[model samples]
Target chain A: QQQVKQSPQSLIVQKGGIPIINCAYENTAFDYFPWYQQFPGKGPALLIAIRPDVSEKKEGRFTISFNKSAKQFSLHIMDSQPGDSATYFCAARRYRDDKIIFGKGTRLHILP
Target chain B: DAGITQSPRYKITETGRQVTLMCHQTWSHSYMFWYRQDLGHGLRLIYYSAAADITDKGEVPDGYVVSRSKTENFPLTLESATRSQTSVYFCASSGYFGDKDRWYGYTFGSGTRLTVV
Candidate 1:
């Protein structure tokens, strides 16, 4: 079964707008959540991550809002730019599980 | 140069042919993983190696084999290529994936686009 579910197969927003992507997980044991971004011809890079101990974490213009009770997390990109266009993937793993499950990716586009 | 790298950036082969994909990491991480990316399927793990000579099968390991001869090299082989195997392959490395440190964000290599006819 797919453990993680993500929405918005494709997203488009204007420059300087806030773009958000949501993800929910079925396994309550998952304690670590991370988001990755991939460009056209390159490998995916770690963007930001968070743990259930906290409700939210922010770095630069990227923020991950998590809800432990709801078993959901969403990524917010503030002042989205054209350079932010890429595919974003959400993943999760139990504290001690070496295997991490990934959600279906969401393609984001920023219109100038 | 001090990160994971995948070679034969692109390859094309016919069905029933054998093809191998190479992955190398300089970080000397304890964990290395292979994943395949397709149009509808996002990224599916094919195999993962915790250390040299120690490997395990992932969700989609059928029709494939992996060998970790050395700490820095993990290779995946397709015994017989199939049209269903035509997808982009990615290799990743991480230090440790458990509760300690709890940082499992991976360092991925440039993908290898394999096409099986």
Candidate 2:
């Protein structure tokens, strides 16, 4: 079973538009959520992360909106640019478990 | 050069042949993990080790073997390579997080592209 589920296997957006990628999880024990960005032929890198306590967290143009009750979270890219085109993955981890559960991932393409 | 490194950025092996992927970290992290990324399937954990000589199976571990005899090295071996096993494999390391309040994300290597023909 997939612990974390992501929607929209792929996404396309115009430059300066906002691209939102969403993920949902069933495990209530999950306390940490993070998003990773990967370019072609490269490993995924940490983009941003959020804790369940806060409703949202932002870093530069990337933001994470988390809803603890709904067990859903989403990643939003503000002023999306062509450079933001990459595969985005949402991941979650429990307090006790060190391993992270990754979503299926969403491939975002920003058109200039 | 100071972060985690994976050997053989690309490899091609015949079916039924044995292949091994090497991962080494200079930070001497206490935790190490192996993951395979496939199209539409995303990233699936193959195996992980919390410390030297302590290993555990992840979501997918069949036909795959891993060993952590040292703190900085973790190797994954496929006894008999299969077409279904062809994918990009990633190695990640993280420090021991005794504090649940603090979140330290994983450091991933460039990844190895393994192709079984």
| CAPRI accuracy category, model 1 | high
Clashing pairs in 2: none
Which CAPRI tier for candidate 2? high
Instruction: Return the DockQ of model 1.
Output: 0.81
Going through the candidates in order, the fraction of native interface contacts each one reproduces equals 0.84, 0.77
**Compared with the true structure, what per-residue lDDT tens digits does model 2 show for residues A1-112?**
9989998899999999999999999998887898999999899998999989999999999999998889999999999999999999999976675789999999999999
The runs of at least 3 residues in candidate 1 whose Cα sits more than 4 Å from the true structure, single-residue gaps closed, are B96-99, B102-104
Cα lDDT tens digits, model 2, B18-89, are 999999999878889999999989999999998999999999999999999999999999999999999999
Query: How big is the positional error of residue A26 in model 1, measured in Å on the Cα after superposition?
Result: 1.1
Could you tell me the TM-score of candidate 2? 0.97
